[model samples]
Target: MPARTVPQVRRWNCPPVTRENVDWAQLATIDLARARTPEGRAEQVEIARDAMHKQGFFYVVNHGFDLAENQRMIDIASVAFEEVDDEEKARYQARIKETGTYLGYKLPQYWVIANGVRDRITHYNFPRNVHDRNHPEALRPYLPEIQEMVEFTHCTILHEVQKLLSLGLELPENTLSDMHPFDDTNHSFWRFMLYDPRSEEEERKTEGVWMKGHADHMSFTALWSQPVTALQIKDHDGQWRYVKHVENAVIINCGDFTEYLTGGYYKSAVHRVIKPPADQEGYRRLNLIYFGYTSDNVVLRPLLESPVIQRTGLTKVIEGEHPTMEKWRKTRTAVYGVSELKKAADGSEYEIVNGVKVTHHH
Candidate 1:
């Protein structure tokens, strides 16, 4: 009798957490007041340091970005995604499913270096405020309204980031006083609009890995996950903890450059996406914009010299400052495309910042 009714299994399955289900302290990134003062900013940086150095991850509340702007970006993202024609959507379905991650429009299975985990999603990339206008490739041009919003978000974040850097290191205001917004390449931000549109065929794939566990290759990542439960962060216990999209708050995690800078004092957090449950089928991840930065030169090794770090074997390495603008043009493919290195199949290449896998589906 039981043989008459075996049901089908789906590709992705994840649990959701309502406000009633969360452990607020476990998810708290900082003390709210410290989030406001430079000293408080320094403490958050210390958390970034602690997270990077020991835990390899931390939640951040109020590091200094405009929450209203972030929420607006989210609104715009939904419009752009829903506007795609069926043909474009179909073309992307395969690739987005292949990487099982939302790297871009359409990607091949092996396009990403992290090939064994959740990869189902979409990404809407936005250009840097100053760099976009001057970028030779920026002429492709998005819609006027879209471009304006993106530019606004990009510049606003950059200002906040600079302030964070100054506060994190306890530097004097304008310590990077000489830095320019459009210096070309040393610092750049890219935003992606990601979502998951579950089609029935996706329910039938065998041994499917939705999105693989990986690290952001840039210095730091500021992400506003679409209030969905798929985004998970690896905790100190090696357990994947779901990062709830807190309303009006952005999540900041350490990235490659951020880690290498403190001589490993700060760590590049590892993360991945998990599929949502079947009953919740057809759920979509709205928009997640990541402000990604690249040093002008790949070799600007982070100098690890904090007093605590100096107490250890870690000393300081003053690698030359990066070249700034030319760096982006040459390294664009590596940053935006999937990893090309041999270890790609095993995800090793995906972990490398400069020498990461390079695929060209975007």
Candidate 2:
């Protein structure tokens, strides 16, 4: 482990972002302050359940942290990317291809976006327990802040949402939260991501897609709102709609693991990032997100004990023996950027991993 160094404030000018007019998707919004009471929790359960069953995406406000706190993390992330030397970053490069863990820096131009053109996205992932690993000198001083945000997101926000989901499923309040202990070994991580501006010709070659449309492999994802308007989600009608940026709100979405746990009752939202709007094309898009994974030892099976699931007669998403979180995470992470896309029977793109079929929508 590396010791913490004196915090150095690096001066890097982050480009300003502008919002443009676009058709934004109308999503369910849940207020966490109201959720603290029993009556409010009951009301939120119905709203959350409907959102999960329909689109698997929603908005959460009054989450205790305000827009200023969100911007502080983004500022630190910008400095980490802009000020860190390339030579130093190489020493901590992610071993996603070999080790199947996103625990370090991932350089830009790593993934194939379209037509053989690589992506212009760079990201750094800090695991749930930040102190257990080494980081760049630029990020060492801010490790405490990163750790605080990680714990707060997992223990405070995620647990509250999980309890509401459990109630929605007619199960005990702790049923879902128990599966994800904060101190347990899991693949959960906080990601600092940047989308570098690309030339119009390069963007055209990639069909205007920065990231392909796919569902996250984890259980839940909490994305802090930012100004750049590039994120979009595939609605239930198979239409793509822009995800509006709401200040001081965290966007919550279910993932494939959640879909499996609920017996496909809750579908995972498929989302993608495209070229920013014309007004924001010259500016870099910075993002802060936390991915919550189940404990390594937990099996990827539906909770058949839930009365809601029992009444619906839903079965497991994956048949036969279920894979543990460790196995599933490794398998999915190993093949993500390097896997060749295969055409499915319905004209959609897909990849098969561990005998399971995962779809990728264009």
Candidate 3:
């Protein structure tokens, strides 16, 4: 008997996004080097606060990271995703479905085919905890450099960003620091994504989108390797716009956990990626992302003492105890799975699956 051959789903052709359709605007950009002086520190804090409160997304430059290091990581990513064979890629496939462990590689189109748009993101996920000794053997070759990137981002970039966020919230400078200490068992992870170039015919079929509008479940997200302009964010006016990419800049955004901790003072931005125009679509897209998460043992609740919370009287925040990362993730996933219909602010009912809000066209 011959082995069975399964057919792959046709690549999703995302609707083409044009300048007329999307309200393109320059997102707020902050330079981390501003924190060196007292006056600059205060200005940077205010800038961070404004960015978060208004849109929950911004860009950072002069973040003290070397561009050569970034290029090196991208080189490694090219080898991992672009150069590897399918059989070799399968060696690091994550057991997210069976065990809810979010480590290792996730092949493209592994989840729902929403609106006939199958996501073509193939990624490798690395946890923030360096002591996690169970990494797949195939991923061991590139683990050291990846680990170095994770540590530098967590300790240097995210740490400083959190301090600014604390200042923005009018809380003690170190208020948000304790939640993600070096020794704490944080669930933050670094993700390296490869968006292979798609044909114009594929784009026409599904539209020019790669990812649908979604929010992350972390405290804050740090984005780099944005050599291309495909990422977009839903702004305050409910308009979709491109998050323009600038050379040597890191984009940051607040996530669900940050929103919860701030008692709704800051919001979790809804963002997605769209395929480039016909001319630019030929080049492959590589993304390096680091998301900051509260430690596993930390309780996710509103910081009641926060001046923003006090003034706003937003007492009711996240309900119940999000006891641990394992428990919270499982519980949330279960809730997103069973819920059939949910009402949005406009009273429109949409379907939910696996914690992703699905929007459909009539």
RMSD of 3: 8.4
Identify the candidate with maximal lDDT: 2
TM-score of each: 0.65, 0.95, 0.83
In angstroms, give how far residue 157 of model 2 lies from its true place.
Answer: 0.6
Ranking by lDDT: 2, 3, 1
User: Model 1 segments beyond 4 Å from truth?
Assistant: 1-25, 31-33, 38-45, 62-71, 86-120, 130-182, 199-208, 277-279, 294-299, 315-362
lDDT of 3 at 345: 73
lDDT minimum window of 10 residues, candidate 3: 6-15
- Model 3, TM vs. native: 0.83
For candidate 2, the TM-score is 0.95
lDDT, model 3, position 175: 84
Per-residue alpha-carbon lDDT of candidate 2 for residues 1-362, written as tens digits (9 for 90 to 100): 89746365554344445557787888999889999888998999899888988899999899898766676788788866887899988998999989888889889888887878888888999999989898998788898988999999999888889888898999998998999899757769999998988887888897788898999988999999888889999988989889988887899999988998899888799999988778877778888899999899998889999998999877547866798988888899889868988988877788887556788776
Which of the two candidates, 1 or 2, achieves a greater TM-score against the reference? 2
Residue 197 accuracy (lDDT) in model 2: 88
